[model samples]
Target chain A: MESLQRIDLVGFGSLLAQLQAEGYTLIGPRLEAGTIDYGAIEGPDDLPIGWRDEQSPGRYRTLPRNDRAHFGFNATPASFKTRLHRSEETVLEVQRGEQGELRFVPVIPAVKKQAWIGARSCELAALAIQDRVLKDSADPDPRYAARREGVFIVAVHCGQAGGTCFCTSMNAGPKAEGGFDLALTEILDGPEHHFVVETGSDAGAALLERIPHSQPTAADLRRAADAIEHARATMGRHLDTDGLKTALYAQAQHPGWEEVADRCLACGNCTAACPTCFCSSYEDQVELDGANARRTRHWDSCFNADFTHLAGGPVRASTPARYRQWLTHKLASWHDQFGTSGCVGCGRCITWCPVGIDITAEASRIRQANGEPPK
Target chain B: MPPTGTERPRLAVWKFASCDGCQLTLLDCEDELLALTDRVEIAYFPEASSRMLDGPYDLSLVEGSITTAEEAERIQDVRRQSKQLITIGACASAGGIQALRNFADIESFKRTVYAQPDTIESLATSTPIASQVPVDFELRGCPINKSQLLYVLNQALFGQRPTLPTHSLCGECKRAGVTCVMVAGGTPCLGPVTQAGCGALCPRHNRGCYGCFGPSETANTQALSPHLERLGMDPPALVRIYRTFNAAAPQFQAESQAHERD
Candidate 1:
């Protein structure tokens, strides 16, 4: 068992500087245009202090929390995957040299030793899933492997849940379980703004050895546990994952797909915002000179008409077919391929989808349509 | 015209009855235009040069809709003269913003816009070049995206089809990391049905997309119009949004016509 330590709000600011001193660039949740997104942070001041976000299906708005507590929001539209697996990557540049020789220049992305602060457990779980798919797999992406190798994580135990959040259902969040270097459970008692911090790795322990901290009391520890417990108990959404993969596989002809197709704009927002959707497509762009070209890989969605393009035409021609492919692949087929379900229950797909096509509700609808009891 | 010893593919830019913005897009490719000229000769562009080489051009870029009877006949001659005719913008692909006149009385429009209605030898409806003649390809955008126009040109040189994704602009907005204005702020957007071009211009500026890039391959405006209505768009506003740039596009035209009836 790991011992917990208490650090005041002032000490939190110093912790960021200490991480910087330790040669890890700090990336934390910072407010951008009323949304909290991960960005470069110099100290605790860069964090979204005293502001919280209200998120529901198809809606998200930031509100004043009526208190001065940092890291108040939950469930950003994007996650660490956005930074790690970029939207567009240039694999290499093919140069036409003098004397008719062709030179291939590989684009090795510049990797930085980064200390990511204020990561939620759902985001961490997403990283782990992406690790299985992109890093540890037989065909590991060298780009993802390089970027993932030099990163420090600071996980935050969730005290509040977004209206679309169902991390409890996915067994992916509401508390920092294990996949973090250091975990912070923010305590906002009357006149006491402090964090109950726990070191998960030796790096975290060494960093804590330098920062000012005190042994936590039993109440502080309970407060940390109770905060996450409250979030878990009052989760805004829920899904019964038991027999889910089998049921989803059996639901190939479910009428729920037609129902979703009626409202699905096929805009590909849910897949693009989804942290686990790893589909990509490549296009060769020729320079105006026509002598030089670059093969660019960009994030593509299954919802795209061109995603399943074959010799004659698209394999999944209809919107219903595309929607079915995305949902089933995310839940059922991913388990077969990666030994785990693709969804981390971050609820970004629900909140960011322009039409609010909630996956949890859709899953239940599909199951219930086939005479499965509602969980 | 006398045949020159140089055998560069002859490129022609033709304008009909619309704004010269699409033709200007080619001009805006100033340095790129210079490089493109190296591969293809600018045989007949009255806007770029006074040189007016006639007939049997290798590639013809038509820039406007057929709003006049003369242009309606002239486009066929252009199609006959060119080996490959590519429609450049919303004007030539769809009938463009000027096609809004198609919904109203052409007589009234003539009387309103011009002092002498009889002198204006215009057709009753503004129509795309495709309605008059066969086009090899139609680039759907208001003033076509510079890179896409260049992409089409590069592909045409190699005798390959330009494989531009005919997906919605929502994908572009998402890939660009732009927040969904429709979802987040309840702003009515046409991005769900609009094609991916203009690099998601309107949404990145924090406003709703106006569907200037026109409809995607599978544009479901019937479904999206209702959601836009839920976001406080009245029937006329819904029709107006779709009927803007690509007003005559069959998909958007159908949706707007339906809303107009409602």
Candidate 2:
């Protein structure tokens, strides 16, 4: 039984200030162009307060919330992964020497000590998933590793679930398990509004000691549990993980893929929105001077037609094959490779998909079509 | 791979029926243009240079579409003369805005737009350089990307291969942290079917992509039309978007033509 402490609204501001004092660039949910996505922020004021996000298949919009809760929003398109695993960056720069000898210089980006505030539990799980995908690989991504160094996390337990969320079924959210400096649950009970904070690490305890906080009351504990419970109960989506990887593998030749392919745009939107996807492609840019060149690695997706391009042409020419590759790799092959499912069940893939391609629904449909009974 | 000797490879820039924007994209390279010229000899570029150097060129960048019969014949000779021929921009790769004449009666267009129809002599339809002869590579875009032009030139000069993505512009938008206007704002966007390389210019600025770079490798504009309708895009607007700079592109052309019958 973990005892939780209560931090008042003003104390939340100081917590942000203390993080800044400790040399961390704050990043969290922000309102930008009719949607709330993650980006750099100054402090608690920059948080998307008094706003809730509406997410459905192929649609997303931010609406005003009645209460001043920063973490009321759902999964955003831009995650902590977006900042850590960069889209495109010059990995190596080659300079032509005076004698025509090439000098290959590696470009290691200057990483900022960032405190990602108001991170959802699903996003935190995504960070851990990416650690295995990018860092634990044979050819580890140093760029991602560099950007992720010495970063602090302020996990926000979801008090509200979006229409497309399936974190409860994925067992990734509503309540954060681990891998956070501190975990916070926003409890809004009548006139009382405060964050029930739980220290997850020694660093969290150190920061909490410096901030204004009081021992949580019995009512506060009940409300905090109730808040997380509300999210779990309202979840409108689910992914049955019982034999999911095996079922996805067995449904490789299923016609459901082709049926979905008719609608699949192969735009790589799902891959972009998915926080756990780690596929990438490299582009070599030769300098105009013909003196030096640069090699850049950018995020790539299996959805791209040319993703499987070989010497002759693309191996997976049809949209069905590409979609299958992505789905299978994310759910099935991912387990064989990483020992865990690639999806964190944040539902950004469903919400951000231009045509609303639901991954879990597709998986369920394909499994059933292949004669696999629903769990 | 610097040519056989210390001599720099000869580079030729040709135009057929374009705004010369693609040629200017090379000149627009400015500092990079100087660097490129330093590496390769600019044998003939009527836009920048008056000096005309004859055949057997190492690399040739062909711009615009083959509209006139003379251009149709000339591209064949140019193909024979040059070791490598790379098409630059929509006109050379797909047929440019002039290709709109393809969907309509050219004779009627000539009479309506031009007074002396007999004086003008062109093929019934404006065709790309690839339609005339085999193209080594194609650098996509309406006006073409300067970085890609330089990259293609670098590849041709160094005897290397160019790797240009034919992926959707949605990837570019995602990379830059730009939300999907189609999904988030319900704004009809062609980013899903359009090829990348414009660095997601329009979507980054909070507007829809007009698909100036043409179609992606797996473009499904057929499936996209229904969603565009859901976003409040009318039939004509839907037909019009696909019939833009890259109209002659098979996928967009099929969608635009399909909607035309509807």
Candidate 3:
């Protein structure tokens, strides 16, 4: 059995160096453009140390935590998927030869080995959902599979919760349950600041050997658990998932849909912020000379009129229909399609929505309209 | 391919009352512009090339709006000479920011801007090409996206229908995985009722949609107005919101008019 170890702040930096030496690009949360966005990190200094985020519907602000903690923020609008699955990619390039024969060339992405640090449990859950949708499907997405291959995940158990977070309601966070090579719990007890690290794989155990760390004490374990317990208790939102899919599916004519649609700009901000939304469209481009053509795939949304554009016109011409399709697919139909809910309850969609449309609140309303008791 | 000596399909570009931002987008397609020259002949484009050619052109991409009486007559002539007419950008598709004159008194505008109002001969209302003459296609955007422009050109050349989105901005946001700025931050966005184009630019930057692409198909401005009101927007603010770049568009025009005090 693997044992939990205690690592100091300095030791964490060393681990980052070790990952770099192993030819892994270290990606973690860093303050950029006034928000904590994930990007390449060299060491602990590159992280958003002593910084925290305040998130509410349509509001995101960064503030100084006045602490030495590196991962003080609960979640960032940028998710791991941005690194795993690119926003735009060329799938194929076509050129006509002198003989009039068309030559097609496939565009493949360059290989990049990446290690993600400070991933929260909800993000991990989202990654798992993406794996099933993009990797474990009948026709696996080569682009996603290529980028996702050999990714080293270092998960952080929540010590704090954001104002828009609802991972506890989704049963996906407050603790690093699985899908990580190493799970870290930051324990801040008085003046003592340390981390309890548990290895989930042989590669994680092997990497831990390179860092200066000691076996965790019984008291260290208790503190780690307590920190996660506090995060769960302090979650800002809750979503009752009991018969949620059925309630949503049944409430097609719910008055709340019209109310929500009336407020919806149909701008597609929610799906863009959602970690699990994976719809895309193909764009065909031809050279000015019309000699060569290329087809590129870019992220697309269901809220787009072109998304449902048929020979005659758009099927869901109304904003209400488009909003209905998005909410239903996200909270209800996603279960039928992926055997799981699309939302991990990270609350990114809620936080990033310009109009401050809370999905949890909408779901509760829908459930209530379907004769289901609210939480 | 046609013989080297065979005349290529003639192309022309026209402008009226606009900032020429959409025309700049054509030039902005640096790499694609070189490739585009091989497919279509640049018969006339004052912004790009001074080399002018008489019309009866195969395709004419029109930008801006009909703001003056002379411009209205010129557009009819351009429409008569061109086989296919495609309106590009907010100015051609809607009335653009200049269409703000449609609501207020044009006589006051002429007097305020010009030293002598009698010297200026302008139309009472700024109007889109489709309103003046039949337009084959209308590309929406403050400055129409280069990729969509290319798609329209390619489809037009190949005798195929263009696949432009008439859906709401919400579709782009969903596909891009952008967070809902309205729900999370309580920011008032016009994304739901607005047309999809500009790739959801404002919302991606953690801002609200400004309705640059105008109203989408079946835009529910009636439904969205109350919601904006509930979010603390007063009547005057709502009027201003709908009277932006696409103020002359029927859906937004009616909505703004409904909120107008006088």
Candidate 4:
């Protein structure tokens, strides 16, 4: 049995100084380009402190919180996956010499140990899903695996949930679960700033020991529990995941698919922003010398009608079909392949989607039509 | 004598007259890419390699539609050189977006999308490769799915038939647990006739289908005609859908012609 360890939260400035001195490339949420995005930070001043986010079906905006707190709300537009798993990379590059000897090699960059400071529960769930798909899968992604192995996550509990959030339904969060080195809950106890930190790994314990900190009292544990409970009660969104895969599969003859085709431009913004979508397209290039060759990989979306074209014609040429493929894979068959739901309930797809298509609402509509009770 | 690993089959990727999106699907297999290359020799991919091996190659994966007098002739040569030939995108299996020319006057189309119409020398209709050659298998999409593409490639190399769905996109939607957007929200959709390849995407994103995949087995466009009309789709709009990417396809062509007569 692992014994519970003591961790004291110092002043924001002091905490930042401690991590900085320990050679951690501290990354946290920062307001950039008028949107909440992730960036490398040196201090609490750079964090989106006292900032809260309000997201509707298809809209997102930032607001000021009553108290100056580091993790006042939920997820942002940028997922932690983007920083870890790149959208596109040159996996291999080949150049031909005059001798015409075809020398082929892979393109892998030197990796670095990264410390992520303000990760949320949903984001951690997304990272774990990515790990299963990109690293643990039979065909492991070497580049993603290399970088993922060196990551040390510091999770922050969500005190307020966003409108698009359904992590509670996804069983992913509202509270920081496992898969983190350290979990932090910000508590306001008069003028004295306090954070309840729980060490989850050896790396976390070592880091905690290095900082000047006293053991947390019973009050600290209660404060942490209260924060999580408050966030759960304040959740702004809900999704019905019960029998979700079967509901989608049974609606093959349902008339809803075509209606979406009329409005959807198949722009593929949802897949791009989604943390778990891993489909990609490949390209091959010839060297200037015309002797050697290499291949490149980039993200691909099934939303595009042309994604499945062939020599004589495309098998699925209609926009409705393409749309159907993307949706089914995300919600239904993804379980068959990955043993988990493709969507993490982060709601980034809803917020980033230009057309403002709400997935949870769509799923609910299907259940209603089938005369099933809403989840 | 036992078979050696060196005797394993070779795979080739070819391109025709469309954007390189389909061929790009092969390159996108980053995680398994290095291992895939080790298993098979990339015999002849003009887009991926300049090192071309003279046919007869084991398997040929072709992308794009048949357009221009030269391409019509080149497709025949490709069929002859390969043991097994598979087509990968809308342009290759159906005529593609360029096939919209089948609805309008060809001379007018050449003048609209091109800077120098005279410089463009193409057939009056953009046709799929199967219209000219014998394709062993056909994978459908505007750009084919990477997993399906990989599946087909693996099957061909091992002398097995790939199990791809021939059902409509509606089947996929049902499996995904998405609500019927058309029935519930009164949104127009094309899932009834469109083939299943892409997992249902538009409806999941809270939108309707646009038929990137061509018609499925025994599609009844006539039955859909009234539903589209009730949804306020005009004759021209209905005709436009049939004539866009896979216009030259027999079923879609016949459907569009009927709309024009009406």
Alpha-carbon TM-score of each model against the true structure? 0.97, 0.97, 0.90, 0.60
Name model 1 segments beyond 4 Å from true. Answer: B1-5
The residue-by-residue lDDT of candidate 4 on A189-297, one tens digit each, is 5664577777788887777777666666787677777888877776666778889889888876567777766655455556766777777766664422234567766
lDDT tens digits, residue span A1-375, model 3: 246899988898888999999999999998876778788999889999889999887678888997878888977877887776677789999998999788999886766889999999999999999999889999988888888886998889999899999998888898878898888999887798989998988888899998999988889899988989888988988899988888888888777888887776666667777788888889877665556889988777776677777989889877678888888887889889888888899998888765678999988987897778786
A best-first ranking of the candidates according to their DockQ comes to: 2, 1, 3, 4
- By DockQ thresholds, what CAPRI class is model 3? acceptable
Off by over 4 Å in 2: A1-3, A373-375, B1-6
Candidate 1 per-residue lDDT over residues A157-198, each given as its tens digit: 998888999998888988868878889999987886799998
lDDT of 1 by residue, B102-179 (tens): 889989988898988888887888899999888899987888998899999988987788888799999999888888
What is the C-alpha DockQ of each candidate? Answer: 0.56, 0.76, 0.47, 0.03
lDDT of 2 by residue, A131-222 (tens): 87787778778888888886899999999899999998878997998889998999897789999999888999899999999988889999
| Candidate achieving the largest DockQ | 2
The window of 10 residues in a row where model 4 chain B has the poorest summed lDDT is B175-184
Regions more than 4 Å wrong, model 4: A1-18, A189-192, A287-294, A312-315, B1-262
RMSD of each candidate relative to the true structure = 2.3, 1.7, 3.2, 11.2
Model 4: per-residue Cα lDDT over B1-262, one tens digit each = 1112687567778888889998998898787576566557888888888999888888888888887899988888888888899999888999888887666789987789899999989788788989999999989887788877777775565566775666566546643435445543456777766777787877777677777778866455766666677777888888887776677778788988998988
Q: Which ten-residue region of model 3 chain A has the weakest summed lDDT?
A: A264-273
lDDT score for residue A69 of model 1: 77
Each prediction's whole-model lDDT (CA): 0.87, 0.87, 0.84, 0.73
Model 2 agreement with the true structure over B36-79: per-residue lDDT tens digits: 77688888888998899897898899999989989988999999
